[model samples]
Target chain A: MARVNATPRRRGAARTDELLEVTLELAVEVGYAGLSIEAVARRAGVGKHTIYRRWPSKAALLLDALSRVWTADLNYRGTGDVRADLREQFLRSAPALATTPIGPVYRAVIAEAQSDEALRATLHEMFLANVEQSTLDRITRAQQAGELVPDVDLTFAAEVLCGALYYRGLLSTRPIDEAAVDSLLDMFMAAYGA
Target chain B: MARVNATPRRRGAARTDELLEVTLELAVEVGYAGLSIEAVARRAGVGKHTIYRRWPSKAALLLDALSRVWTADLNYRGTGDVRADLREQFLRSAPALATTPIGPVYRAVIAEAQSDEALRATLHEMFLANVEQSTLDRITRAQQAGELVPDVDLTFAAEVLCGALYYRGLLSTRPIDEAAVDSLLDMFMAAYGA
Candidate 1:
């Protein structure tokens, strides 16, 4: 995947990146309902035809924008330690949820997906696949190293780990502090440890 | 607090409940922005004065209606075990998130609360308080029973436990299943267990 801030010197690539950036900005400002290709073009100083040439629909554009922005820091080094990996993975995710525009955009997209079937499918394919994969990979490594119970449900465990953080960031008014992160890691280890 | 569907024998109470019911129905249909006392009266076969005599504004009426309908399940029991209590509590909550109209109302209210402080305050005071209180009570009891570590941060732990479910239900299109609930409980146990 291309670096998020990589400037596109090529004309076509620059235009595409500009369109995605405008789309994301509009999504934050006015929400998914208020976003449009025309608005994005106006914001980006591009034409509607340029946007249409690259993307099929507003949902398609939105999905591409989301995918471009959502780079997970999946750099977990398995030192034969499952608990450490889980903690590291969660630590990476916590900052993303707190510091990025992706958090609010993520909330808007999920709200949009509730009503838009095509968008829902697209989001699931683009976002959910990678998240589930990263989680499953970590759990599988842990299980293989005998750090976790052999019969532990990997998919369910992953969701619970990520799901707890998701709950805090999007749903609760409180911030996800270091203590909360450590507690989550502690909880995971207690439940899944061999 | 009154029973959610308590019969109102008094004329005033009956009329109040009737108006609140109309408000809830309209909120569900048209969302918070489109809901108004005039529209609610029209829908309920009542007058504007009838609404004003009770709630001072649309926000107040919506808050009252939400309070009445958005009660959480207080079905958790510690049994001197934090893990078992969490599993049972979430199992009960999972169904409510998946099958209840309260789920949509919660989503709509949360989205609206992003911009409206009065509504947000009322929601926190009336609706969220119940949830927070119930969860905190369970955690506190577990701490006293030595099921949880003495130094376990009750407030943060509560957020981790509840925030995850709230995040998944409000943000994700996917259902909150039993397996997810179990995994969360396991994580909680791992973190806070004595």
Candidate 2:
């Protein structure tokens, strides 16, 4: 999304996708700490300015790549059962973050964000905030439909839902499977289910 | 705890404590990525071998230091009201992770653990597993006292509880305040409170 405007109209999106793919590959190979704009350029066969023209920094570039990896698979089904919708979405989308390239690179980016405030802000705005908001949106509709208990604040619930998944999926060494998701959703439903 | 036996006589314990304190100071000052044995040794007024003799790696040293910072707090009190105890313990214990010299340093170590399996195991064994298990212990007593639903798996609940706190407290840029803690417990009680 960052550099989408600069590339030529046709094949531009494809080229951006390819560049991002390469970025992820390189991130996996050398790690986020070792990844550089110069290295990305060299590997992608593009000029350094070309990479820099779109992304302001290495974090920015990798963030975009992470966004691409995450964007496609995260849509919730809203199957009318908020719990089921959440469970479905969780099973579908959460595993990618656990997989290689994304997990390690994402962790490194998160690590770097600890020291770099600007990167932290961007990471939240571009990634985590989106996930959190999408979750809120799903549960909000369910609450309005009376699938959830009336008038209780669900924002923290959303955070806990997504946060638990993210923590288990990406941050920790544990694997989140169907049984785990079922237990989580069961507790969630016991709390919020109407 | 690692190098305690290596030191001799009455001052041995004090020297170990001072070294761990210096390690933490260095972690905060240089950032974990830039922290080194030489840096810690030079800052602590000790030889490099002396620092290395106790901990095999920088991660090992920092992990031990983290153990010290975390050791003094984190006990969960059984007030006969599980929710109150949880809320009280959360308020007392969770803030330290959100504070400087702990939050940032802990995040860096967690990030490093993402790539390093040994570090991940050590972190879980020493730090996170303890937190998770302690939460479980607190909740298990409540369940046995008939304060929670019978025959339900509380392990995932414990994970979600601590994981959400850790996520919001350490990982995310968001602040976990009293209101947030109340909201979290509200949902938890709704789910599990009997």
Which one is best on TM-score? Answer: 2
Residue runs of model 2 more than 4 Å from their true location after superposition: A1-19, A36-56, B1-19, B29-31, B34-58
Residue range A59-178, candidate 2, lDDT tens digits: 888988988878855577877888878888888876666666477788788767766778887788777878888888999899999999988888889899987887676446677888
lDDT by residue (A124-165, candidate 1, tens digit) is: 666765676787798888888787888766676676667677
DockQ of each: 0.34, 0.55
Cα lDDT listed for each candidate: 0.71, 0.82
B7-111 in candidate 2: lDDT tens per residue?
A: 565577888899999999988988878999999899889899998898888888888888787774557888889998888888787776657867788878877
Relative to the true structure, candidate 1 reaches a TM of 0.72
iRMSD value for model 2: 1.6
TM-score per prediction, in order, is 0.72, 0.82
RMSD of each: 6.0, 5.0
Cα lDDT for residue B32, candidate 1: 68
Say what the interface RMSD of candidate 1 is. Answer: 3.3
Model 1: clashing residue pairs? A167-B163, A186-B190, A186-B191, A187-B187, A187-B190, A187-B191, A190-B190
**For all the models shown, what interface RMSD does each have?**
3.3, 1.6
Give the fraction of reference interface contacts each candidate recovers: 0.40, 0.63
